[model samples]
Target chain A: MTNTTHLIRDARILGGERADILLRGGRIEAIGPGLAADGAQVVDAAGAVALPGLVDLHTHLREPGREDAETVATGSRSAAMGGYTAVFAMANTDPVADTAGVVEQVWRLGREAGHCDVHPVGAVTRGLGGEHLAELGAMADSAAGVRVFSDDGMCVSDALLMRRALEYVKAFDGVVAQHAQEPRLTEGAQMNEGVVSDRLGLAGWPAVAEEAVIARDCLLAEHVGSRLHICHVSTKGSVQIIRWAKSRGCDVTAEVTPHHLLLTDDLAESYDPIYKVNPPLRTAEDVEALREGLADGTIDVVATDHAPHPSEAKETEWCHAAMGMLGLETALSVVQHTMVDTGLLDWAGVARRMSETPARIGRLTGQGRPLAVGEPANVTLYDTSAERVVDAAAMASKSMNSPFNGMTLPGRVAATFLRGVPTVLDGKIQ
Target chain B: MRHLLSAGDLTLDEATLVLDTAKELAQVGGRSVKKLPTLRGRTVVNLFYEDSTRTRISFEAAAKRMSADVINFSAKGSSVSKGESLKDTALTLQAMGADGVVIRHSASGAAHRLAEWVDGAVVNAGDGTHEHPTQALLDAYTIRERMGRLDGLRVAVVGDIRHSRVARSNVLLLNTLGAEVTLVAPPTLLPVSVRTWPCSVSYDLDEVLPKSDVVMMLRVQAERMNAAFFPTAREYSRRYGLDGDRFARMPDHAIVMHPGPMIRGMEISAEVADSPRSTIVEQVANGVSVRMAVLYLLLSGSGSGTGN
Candidate 1:
């Protein structure tokens, strides 16, 4: 926390009325029309939209193992640059964050980096092997205070095990973020199982594969009377299932990735591995449905499944390539382009989906707070009118696997303040 | 055409041009000197990541007949098995100044991926169940030769449509050439989205055989039985196999086609394969001409786009 007061002048608060916000003592000191700077460092944030700093519920900071791909420091820098103040780092890492020691190390690395808050999500299965449960209670009890447990890269396919996990996390008020893909059904799935995969001769990932697991997990969560969070809902059927699960009064929350909102399976026609992802990009109908689901509040949050892999991992044949795309740096822009510009969502809705709900879902107290007085000074000023072509090399993440490369997207994060300190300013990492 | 990576990539004009060029080139096989100077001094590399003696020999014969210097790089006992990536292998081929590369690999989209790395034209001989544009071209050529046309002809592509690159290419190429293609196979052997394809599908081979002007039998791998693609070879043969009775039911002018090394008495009986109506031998002979036309078009500037 910095004592140096900062005054953000004339910024639209959540795309609403313009106001000046004062930051002091790690909290919003004041917010009103024409507030005086009072000898503080003044920032000219004219025409930018100010909202609560974004919080990502799903991010892969490949630390303690695959550091060549990403470290907690690099990924934290990436999150902050993407207007994120807090991000829950997933547990599918080397040595796996199933143990308290691993989770604590990741949490400590976040603290040392100080770019953004990193809450380590515990593993649901030991080593994510899908057999025995990890020490979720111990991880929640540890200094990291993990509130999200997931086997995000791999689905927790075992029904009894999924039920037990959903029930087990309840003791600590934790949520199991399921990856939601049936392993056997998606054994050799390379892309969406439809016209494109058929034409390209790549293996198909059926929508039922995801929907079946989601349907089962929703029932499991309901039966166990525990909170279930679905990760990266990619299909229309999945949206319907999740919507049904929600209407049934199942305590469930779901997140849609930024990539899924804008991209589709047609990209796989290029045979480019950059567009290849798990629960692979679906059809245009699925994209529209996902957009509608997010717009209608059926989808709870927009999490950047910011999976980064080494260039070599993605620079190969589509089948031989790894399944993921860099998301953190381009998440906000994609949200703006697909949702805000398309009139499906407004700035406030963007805040709710990208920040508030994600922080609430992860149980983070300081993040996703309103841009008002007496709240934690985690704020992001986004230039919504600005647009630039996405360059993978220009991104902060260690990997260059952004699917949005060369595509122009609206809204650049001008500044991101984590607890009154600027982790990113003037669209550059501070 | 810079690369004949997928039959779907071909337009009607391009597909027709390949067939016409092959028809003219077929005359060379009957000449005193079975050679064309169209691709002389050009280097063609046959990169086989999978063992395909037949395909390798066909491409080699085509390139050699065109007077193009040919280099056969079999993946076996080569740097490919030593864990060298496809990109590295492509770079090595690029370094050797290959003017056109005919690739056969066990991974779908390997040819597409190779096209991205190397500057040479990529002719996908067979890329795991993805595509075999040359094979489709040859099949198309043989059909046009035997039936005198491709338009409005009923071609029944039978067996293992899910795992047959030949079936995929032929379905696409035949469809592009204005032929009506019916994919005949068990539900387990067909793609989930086969209904979306520009072709009809059937579960019963006997029903399709009577209507088809050309019946193409695909080689079903015996290993697929272990995964329960079918109950047993005998059971599969009992239902889907083409024997004398089944072949007799076809239209009198209808020809039998197979992208061979066919499993005798399995997908097709020996009697049917040996029948005069069988274009199996001519298909192989026509393969050389079709491939020659493909290499000539992709390598020479006569085609719309020169190979990069």
Candidate 2:
């Protein structure tokens, strides 16, 4: 709905040759050297990388139930700040986004916020009970058009039920995103099972628990001839399984979270709940495998899984603490550090993994499009040379549970244009 | 010596100092004047989240013998039962100006978490299946008393090593003291990563028993049977339990110890438990002296100045 003409000058188009991008209405009007402004607002992006606005395949915008943690409006603002033009909202909310009404309501909230596009993910189970199937057809047919179905925080552990959900989603060209975990193997799991868990006396969440379920689901997806998306693949064993499944040509896509790529289970030595998370932070070797997997395109996207929790939920004993950390505001910086700074991926590769592939996985066409003329002007200006210490309190999200708090991270989102409208300008919300 | 949260935190020298100090304090147990004024004005709080009459009273007696004011905060009658968090309870204890906080909780790392919230010295009484440094100290003191030396001594710790905090603390502390220790338990009753521990592990107690100078039996909770850690108590007892015939395999000078509230005829025979070689009763008495040494060394400025 924006008509503001903007002339973004001397920005490296996907870290390539410098060009002037003229955004008119909601599409790119022109892209060339020294383009005329014609009374348009001029932004000096002389040293920034201009790529497609980022898209997250996984995000928990806790609304309609746990508004105390994060709402759609605040989560959308946080997303805009993170250079994300769109995010897939997880369905594990209070009322549970199982029906069409909840999905439509969540979609409406994102529209009203005007910061970013929020695609509501429908629950695969009725209440994520892992027993009966939810009304997946109704959710996909609703105004929200939920294409991704998941029982994210809780896994659909029942094998027969998982097969049915994977098969049912094929009616709408939908992809079933599974939070892969074998429930019994991970019962009373506190952190990663290893020498560390053995030393600390915390219950171990073994890698086989996640790998077993992922292996089963990949086979199910291949047998049913349906597309399956694995959410937040954490273990190195999981990467090998997905890579093996791809060799057999299973229509499966996988994502790795920002924290999983950087943090490891050794942080649990402090017994601080801030380090506590689901599929809990793994080993350094696993981190290397994940980075390698993402670089090789074995892992298609870098989903935020930007789960936020209230302070009370995280400030207690490790076992009593909640299971996620804030990721929307820190996702790109972590990727820049763990991927680009390591010389494993260039800026163009980043656009593919963080934006293009994620959008393709979510079936999002408006997002992940190239920054060429006549395309939707979803652009992000990133200052790759910049660095700042992450301050949890300064984040746009309602919760102050960022695990990266006080850690210096590279890259800053200088500006974000969502459909020609400046959602973020000069690193501040418009 | 700011916090005795884990037995692994102790060095050889620090553990020796505690044992030497406890030996001196053990003399006070035989004297008519059993009280020491070293910690006269200090306040010690026993903040127990789990019901452990034995551990709580041992800590209370230790603090009282040193003339420190003791306050027992059991979770049953407190605001903790009404949903007060551990951090909130820690802050409350902090407000009361506790010089040392002795905590026993059902959650592992609860003591470590409390250490972050309070400035006072923290002593872990027992935390989940994690560690009980004081219990290990007393067990170590009793072994040293009977064996005359810890170096080159063979020790076998049998039963539920997975859930026994005593076994974890003893393995770490005893290994630090230069004792060659072996853990004897069923594969399911032992942690999978026990190979990484400083001590050796075994499944057969009889094989480990004859080579031991000290045989310590850990209590196998009856509830562990329902969880199928073992098929039945009889099956576990037949394989790993200590009885007369098993005890006969130990060296003549070797001692039998249990961190008590014994599950009679299950993990140990009543006859062996009451045998002259058994130090079960003396371990309880030695617990007071060892805890007194820990408190004095951690709280008194002079003792802590040179301590770990």
Candidate 3:
């Protein structure tokens, strides 16, 4: 029971005018220039930019299995440190979050952890097999009340199954986030299909493999009049398709990962598996196109897709190693460096893309609220001028597979208030 | 060089040094003693994840001729099959005082990964479809031994260019050696990014055969058609196969070469493979001397001295 009152002083709200914020009983009591409350914990937040706490629509907690890689408690702590107030945990766990029982168990674990609200994303297929549909209605009606369904790690490749899943989710106002990839076109794929894969003689993962699926799913969603969300749009061709779909007024939304907006396939030249990912990192032109799409609202939100792996999974040879990188802890810093600091998006735009829009997409009612009176006190204070050299050993997650280990990135989270309860203070988890 | 992982890492001077050393070392194959004391105390380990009896034996013979101790570690029946990772295997070899590791893996860039873990010199035998640097060296040696020069020679590498590690290394090395190389393969057989390679690509094999001073044929795996890369074995052999009719179009001084265990009826006909112009047999013989030169240059501090 967190009932403590907190007074945050001289913070810039939403990159706007500096003011004092008074939070009491998990609600914003007042916002003014010189607010004072007796017995309130005073946080000297001068020169910090305050925004709505971030929300991640895609994060892999790796619980109920693969605890050696990450657990709910560890992953949530990482999210809280990254200024995320809510996260939709992915459905690619060991038992697969397809049944009501699994999602309820994950929800209870998140409540116990008390760092961030964990919304378990139900699997659209049984065990993500891509053959048959899972119990979508049961999961939506469960205590967890899963509103987002996805077969993230594996694409719902079968067309009929995808169309059925999209239509079924509409009954409960749930969105089907598709991991767009054509399996046959990406057989034995190692990296992006381009000059780099050819020079290295590695197997090529062509962009058409991803674009073909997104194009098909968009038309299917338009036909069924169901909401569709594309996960991890990685190619320029995908951006063009998504832009065209939005122009057609289809109930379609898309997300670009923090990695996709910054990193490119040239990093794979080192043969380091840490750069390996699904839909593989693409070219510089693709990165620019994704940034443009996000700026123009063609892409709806920025999802972390925070995948963690054990050291053994990433330390092996490139082809034999797993395909993911740590993103939760460094996601905000990357966005600030690539998007905010570059003048592509302002702080208010950052709040909408990173917090408000993701919350709306996942239907997280308690998150992504404005810093105003009577709203939920979920606020993040960020020192925008500060720089951090990412250190994997110092991270909250259990795995050390961070691709940004030695990178010097801008901005640091000073404090994160999850429902007026300070989960992080002075850049340290409380 | 500390590592011979890719032919692209070699300069013209370094490649010429290797070929010149192999030329001097070839005479040792005929000597009664046949062994050199240059690397007498060194240890070389052949860590092979893929089975290739010919390459393994050639490397073994090269190491033995230089009087180095050899240990062969095959993936089958080894700890590698027992779930031990490549890093662990490399650490175990490093602990055993291996001075050099000759690795053959099915994954591209495996040798580069092993080089980062071990302190010894790493030599790539054949890593997936990436590179086989020593094979290129031996091919270069065979070409130079026959024609006595590599400058401005017209070479055509035909068939299965997309899946051939040998063709990749040959193109890079031959281009560095001042030879103009043409990659002759069906459009489906060539990689989509072949335009970026330092060679010209052609679908017609016969058109380039007459102009080619050296013709190298890469083996075509029958399993490629399982992915629909080509139609059938008969059709592929008819169009791209180097029969005697295509061989007659080549210049009189031109040589035919194939890295062996040749499929007689598939990529190259038996007549062309057994012809007097064929250097296929000499390629195998030159593989040992070229490997010896590489091992000596990498391990010994003799500064390219003759192994007397």
Candidate 4:
């Protein structure tokens, strides 16, 4: 454990007033101009923007099964480098994180890794089969204390099962994150169902397939009085549904991925499998709508949905390749480029969408806290002016399937502090 | 010139040159000595991941007539069936000194990807529902031969336009040749992006049939239909199918064409397919000459004198 104090000098706190922060005993002791503390390691952050550590509501740390693609340790390191203090690990692993034993094991692995808090999301259904509900109460009461339940790689498509999963999560204040896709409509879908899919001869995944399930679940949640979360809302139609659902005071929230906000389905024109993803990148108009949704309050947060896959899985023809792209390491950079630099969101808004809202939606504690005294010192020092071309090979994740490779994105995480302990220092993992 | 990956890759001039060359080569097919000495030492490989006996034999015959060595590599019962990747197969062909590789795969853009891996010229014989450039060339040649020109001609492509690689190639090539093309199919059979294509679209084939110079019927594969693109075969035959009644509605000089192995009773009737105005058989014969021109131009380069 880190028992020493840290003195972060001359940093813009929350992109506001320049101040010095003194961390002692794993909490911010003082925040003021020219703060001095003896026997503390000094971090010179003159031009850096200090904000609350980011949290991801969706991330697939592929362990307990697909180690060739990613493991908990590697994914955690990637998260730390991306300035994330907590990540909700998805439940689509080999044996699937349905039981309390598996959830605790993943949680224990996260603790051992010591980079970030890996909150294991328990599978809503046993083995993610979508036929029967898993031991939701048992997983919530376990040491892992799963506060989020999902059958993410596969949607909980059955209406009865989805309603039941939503109802069951209310007992423990758990949120059921729905991967909103109708299975039959997306059976042979290779990309977004529009002009690009038509041109490429790949099967289309219609926007209605996602919107239909979301519209149904929102009504189910309203009927059952349980909190619902939508994972990776990719279409304008989905955003409209979520907005309408929120208008009626249904306890619903939605997230858009970094890739979906910036990339479009036109990238699939190259027939490159690297651009292939589930709920595939949509059109430019959809991208604009998603951006507007986030800029307003329609879309609640930005989740990485940081899926990782090995080279062989993504190196084949588009139809034959596995679906997913690495996102954890480049998520913030993409956000800064797409949202902040475009003048759509300020740094405070960035903290709200990336850190506060996601943590509140996932019910994560000791995260999404403001940079104030007596608060937990989970802080990220970012250089907003720094620009770097993304190189997938240089990423901390084991997988190099990032769609953002070679893209010039703004901002860089200079350092990250998890409870005053430097997990990433000077852009490198400690 | 180096690769025939798409019909869009050809300009009007290059397409006309290929058509003119095919016309010259068609005469060679009717001669007592039906062989050319243009590509004596060149090797052409037919790498087919999807089975297409018609396209494979046509390319083999084209290469043989040009006096080029030909190798037919079918994916079935081959190393490709043993999980060998397209890259490995392409590398193997590159090592074997293939001068041209004509590929037919079930995946779109397979030939384009193979072109990046090999040093030889790549020809997309048929790649999924993406494009079949030679078929387009042969169709254009037939249209020009029958109608005397492609400029301002009204060409109506009927049936499953969504799944027809032949229709896609023809639309692009025919558009480049200054022809006004119209796609006639049910809304489900038409691609959602058909509006972006260089052609107009109509749901009524009867309306389009009456005002066309050429009616090209794309084969409707019953096996490829997993969902109901149309109500039934009988209903599709009644609506979009080309029968003698629809044939009689066409202008006197208008021709009927089918990229053959036609579903005789489905997309076209037997009588309409065998009519004197039907260029179905001639399309097959012209396919060899067009492919021969493609193989010759790709392997020998444009400036090379015909080594008579």
DockQ: which candidate is best? 3
Score every model by TM-score.
0.97, 0.98, 0.98, 0.97
DockQ for every model comes to 0.69, 0.72, 0.80, 0.59
- Which portions of model 4 show Cα errors greater than 4 Å? A1-3, B224-226, B302-308
Q: Of the pair 1 and 3, which is ahead by DockQ?
A: 3
Alpha-carbon lDDT of model 1 = 0.92
Evaluate fnat for each of the predicted models and list the values in order: 0.55, 0.57, 0.73, 0.39
Error of 4 at B245 (Å): 2.4
> Candidate 1, fnat value?
0.55
Clashes of each: 0, 1, 0, 0
Alpha-carbon lDDT, every model: 0.92, 0.93, 0.92, 0.91
Candidate 1 residue runs with Cα over 4 Å from true position: A1-3, B31-33, B302-308
Give residue B104's error in model 1 in angstroms: 1.3
> Clashing residue pairs in candidate 3, if any?
none
Interface RMSD of each: 1.0, 0.9, 0.8, 1.3
Candidate 4 structure quality by residue, lDDT tens digits, A108-131: 999999899999999999999999
TM-scores for chain B, listed for all candidates: 0.97, 0.97, 0.97, 0.97
TM-score, second chain, candidate 2: 0.97
Candidate 3: how large is its RMSD? 1.9
Model 2 clash count equals 1
